[model samples]
Structure formats: structure tokens, C-alpha cells
Target: MQTISSCVEAIVLEQPFLEEALSKGIINYSALADVLQDDVSQTLGKPVKAGAIMMALRRYKDRLTVSKPYYGLNALLEQLGDITLRSNLSDFTFRNSNTLIDSQAAILNTIKNKSHIFYTFTRGILESNIIISSSEKEAVLESFKNENCIALKENLSAISLVLPKHNTKVAGLYYQILKRLAWQNVSLYEVISTTNEFTIVVEDTFVDSAFSIIKNLNKN
Candidate 1:
């Protein structure tokens, strides 16, 4: 049995994500505590220790992004299979020898045989694919289609932005913006952030709401 205080300390110190949550600015610690308890209990399939519960809350505190709410037409459309969601993926292709080589000998053999055979390593850029998204939004939603929508070829359409390093301020601003937009039933394909600005990809129909949310936040 871990003391609640110790649990909190352990969580705060162990997880980098806790800080990420705090930067978003809208998290309530008490509410987050409940969510953490549920998560840990679910993961363990039994009641978690008091310390673990405390740790969960502390862990959540430092997170930069939180889940968004979905409702309205977009929600209905999703249930009806009318919308498509693009997911962020990590894909890689590597070329190596067909022969079985063991440990150091393999590395030495590969290096030695480097000139005799062609070994190619290929990787995909950290970019989102648009082909996975549905075209229904584009046909019926005029506002979504015309708004500076850049095509990444195939079927993917995106609006990209750059942000500075993964710091509190930068994470907080974007997290707040995306959360609100998502609540308005805007389904973002991806929200990718680097050391700087963040980029979000949404279905065409949700673009109007997304724009409105951003504009409203700016005014505030």
C-alpha cells in the first residue's frame, strides 16, 4: 500500500505526459483523478492501490493534450458510416541480407559483403496520409472544401502549421484550441506537433466549425 502523497510524487516525477496535460490549461485535477482511478483499475482488473490512484492524478496533471468530445451531425454520420478518419501511421521499409547471420559475425559479414550486394533502407516521412478519409464531406460541404485545403496527393487533404519546441506554452495554446473544436463535433484526422506549431487535419464538413472555434478562441 502506497501513501497517496508518495503516489502523487512518483507519478509527477515518472511520467513526462503529466506536464503535457497541464500545458493544455483546461484540466481539472479532481476530475482527472477519477479518470485515472478508472484507467488503472481497468488495466489491473482489480482495485488499484491508493498510491497508484494518486500517481494517476499526478501523471495526468502534466499532459499537454486531452481527448475531445464529439456530437451532433458528425457524430451521427460516424455511426452511419458516412465519415472517414485518417490515422497517423509509422511505416518503414528496410533491406537486409537473406542469409542468416548471428550477432557480431552477421554485422561483420554484412559490412564485408556491403559491396557485393545492394542493401537499401527506406523510410516514410512523418506525414499524414489523406487517402483514408472519405470524400462525402467534400461533395456536400462547400465551406470545408475551399478553405485553403492543401492536397497531399491521393485522397488526403490537409492544413499544416508549424510550432516551436515541445514546451508548456506551445502545448497549452494548441491543446485548448483543438479540444474546443473537437467538442463542436469536428473530427480531426491528426494533430501533429513538432518543436514548434501544431497541425490538424479534419473532415471537410467540420472545417467551418473548426474555423469558428479558432476564431472565437482568438477573440478571447
Candidate 2:
């Protein structure tokens, strides 16, 4: 049931850079097809002609370029609201376990009185990530002492954005913002976002540059 076209799409989609290059029509389709012929043939359990793969690549490129309209996305970027930075943040990751919630709850309960403290949690299937003020590093470690610590990083800062209302209705909003940051070579440790709030965490050194890049993303 796996056709050459489907295989080509699956392979290209796995690599975002390739998909982007193809969308911009920067890649040589025939050359790419030749490169992909082996993978495609192997995936299909048979040999496929490079010309056939090339045709499939062309069709996929057409769809990718046509479907990624950024008209609404542009307007959304132009409407970004206040930008703020929080320094001296620490990042922690722990494997998910039944008691992970209890450990997180303890941290929150302890920080509740400190209205100025910054804290956020993102729970994944395999692990949970916690970002908190570095001042509270000891507290977090003690609370999560029993948990399996996967990683811990300090000397980082977070830059958060206040997005315009109805930002979710626009397509590729995050991609546009992140693309600009990527162009400037800003290294992002993590990206966190809510419906109307977007935040990026980077090392202390990159915060100012990242802030500047995002603040002027809409300017001509």
C-alpha cells in the first residue's frame, strides 16, 4: 500500500529542513530523487525509478508551498504585546513517576507565598520539565530528591511574549517567531507557550539578543 509518492512525503516530512528547502524550491528535485531512490526503493520492498520519485517530490513541494499561507500569521506577529525577561532561571528534568505530581505540588505550595517567583512545569510522557527561579534551586532539588533527575541546567533566562488575542487562529505563528530567532543564531534551550503567551528560554548570554530579535520581528 506504500506508494513512491507516499514514501517520498514520509521521508521529506521527517526532515523539516528538507521540507522547507523544497517549499522554497531551492532543492534540485532530480538530484534529491536520486539520493532518495535507495531509501524509497527499500521502503517499498522494490526498486523505483528516480524519475518517478522526482515527480512525487515536485507534487509534494507544490502542496507544501501552496498550503503554508502566512497572511494571518503576519498580522498576528505585528500585534505582539509586551515583552519581558526573567533572569537567573534554572531548568530541571525528571523522569515521570506516580509521585512526580506530589513532588511538583510541594514545590508550588512552598513558592505560593513568594508572589515574585517564576515557576512553570511541562509534563511529558517520559519526563517532566520544571523551570523555576534559581533562588529556589535548593528547594526544588530537596522536594524532588526522590525523583529520577534526568538533567539540570542553571544560568539561564526566559523571555516571554504577550501575544495578541486570537493568536491561535493564525497558522504557523510559532514557526514564524522561531524562524526569525534561528536566522539570528539564537540558541533556544526550550520553548514554552500558552494560547496568548509565548516564551523562550536561552542562556544568560543570548537573552538580550533574543529579546531584541523577537521585539522587532514585525518591524519593517
Candidate 3:
């Protein structure tokens, strides 16, 4: 754990831009000290002493605040701001060949298989991967099996619960959860959101642990 002062110095060192803000008295030094301690303590998983906090304050006194308080914006943004929510909780499901429906129908149906395609709809038109304009469900179904078109198979080993937006509050929530996973040495392959959902593909082995973590998060 960082002392109150060490945390301040760390913040200043991490974000050099904050120095100018401090000189102009835009930030209250005491408040800045308190916020850093509170935030970092949670991250470091231990109580931060005030003396170390004061040391950090003096160390970065010259470059304390440039525009605003510099806590851990980079760390939080790196983890949280990238998430996109394409589909809601209802949109995710597993599919199997026995019950594979047209891409459009699959949007509402949950099938179980290793391979599946996810489709997004806009104004009754399938704008994303389902590309062709179909007059009816049968036509839409035919488009998927069309020999002229190249079909991409999506494989899901593990599911990622994407948040709708990447606001400060939501970012904080993900950062905390992701940090725990990182500590356990989990690797994540993330797909950035062009649509609504932020997707993270993890190995099948970690699904149970990941789900447990999420379930615990929900309880809190």
C-alpha cells in the first residue's frame, strides 16, 4: 500500500499535466491527498498511511495538479473506457447445428453450439453481417446459406458481459473486476464495440471462475 504522500507523488509522476493545475490552486491539496489515499488503498488492497501521503505531496508539490486531481485516470481508462454494449443481456446465447435458425431469428433464440453468428438489426433491416436485404424470414435464411457469400464462423469459448456505456461510474466497476482477474493471471481477448456490446473472449477454463467473480459482484 502507498502512504498518502507516496500516492500523491505517484499520481503526479504518472500524469505530468497535473503539475500546472496545482500551482494555480485549482485543486485543494488536502482534498487531493484524501482522494488519492482512498482510491489507491482500494486498488492496492491495504491501508495507506498519511506520512507516505505527505511525502508524495512534497515530492510532487511542484507538479501536483494541472487541470484536476490526478488519481489513476490512466489505469481506470485503460481498463474501463474501451467497453461497448451492442446487445443487452438478452442478446447473448449459445447455438448448436441442430437448432440453428436464420441469423435474424438467432438474435432472439438461444442455441447451444461451439460456432454461431451474431447479427444486429436496424429499422427491420439486417445492417451488419447479415448484409442481404430479404423480404421475408425465408429469404433471410437463404441469404445465410448462399454459396456466393463468404460466411464467417464465430466461436465462443467464454462469454463477456458487456456494459452499455463507458462512463466514469461504469468504468470504475469494470476496473475493479478486471483487476481481480488479472491478479489471477487470466488472459483476455477483447473486441472493441462498433455496436453496443463490449466483448471479451477468454479461454473456456476460466469461465467458471469468471462467472463466480461476476456473480459475487452482482451481490455487492
Query: 178, model 2: CA deviation in Å?
Result: 4.1
Name the regions of candidate 2 deviating beyond 4 angstroms: 93-114, 123-129, 138-151, 178-186
* Residues 172-212 of candidate 3: C-alpha lDDT, one tens digit per residue: 44455665566577666333233334444444556566555
What TM-score, over all chains together, does every model reach?
0.33, 0.75, 0.33
lDDT of each: 0.42, 0.91, 0.45
Cα deviation at 180, candidate 1, in Å, is: 1.6
75-147: candidate 1 lDDT, tens digit per residue: 3222221122233322111223222122223333434534532111122243212222233223212322322
- Among residues 3 or more apart in sequence or in different chains, the pairs in candidate 2 whose N, CA or C atoms overlap within 3 Å are none
Model 3 has an lDDT value of 0.45
Question: Could you list the CA RMSD of all candidates, in the order they appear?
Answer: 17.0, 3.5, 14.4
Cα lDDT tens digits, model 2, 1-220, are 8899999999997977788789888999889999999999999999899999999999998898778775677787788899989999999999999999999999999999999999999999899999999999999999999999999999999999999889878777787778778878999999998988999999988988999998898874
Against the true structure, whose lDDT is highest? 2
Task: Evaluate model 3: give its TM-score.
Answer: 0.33
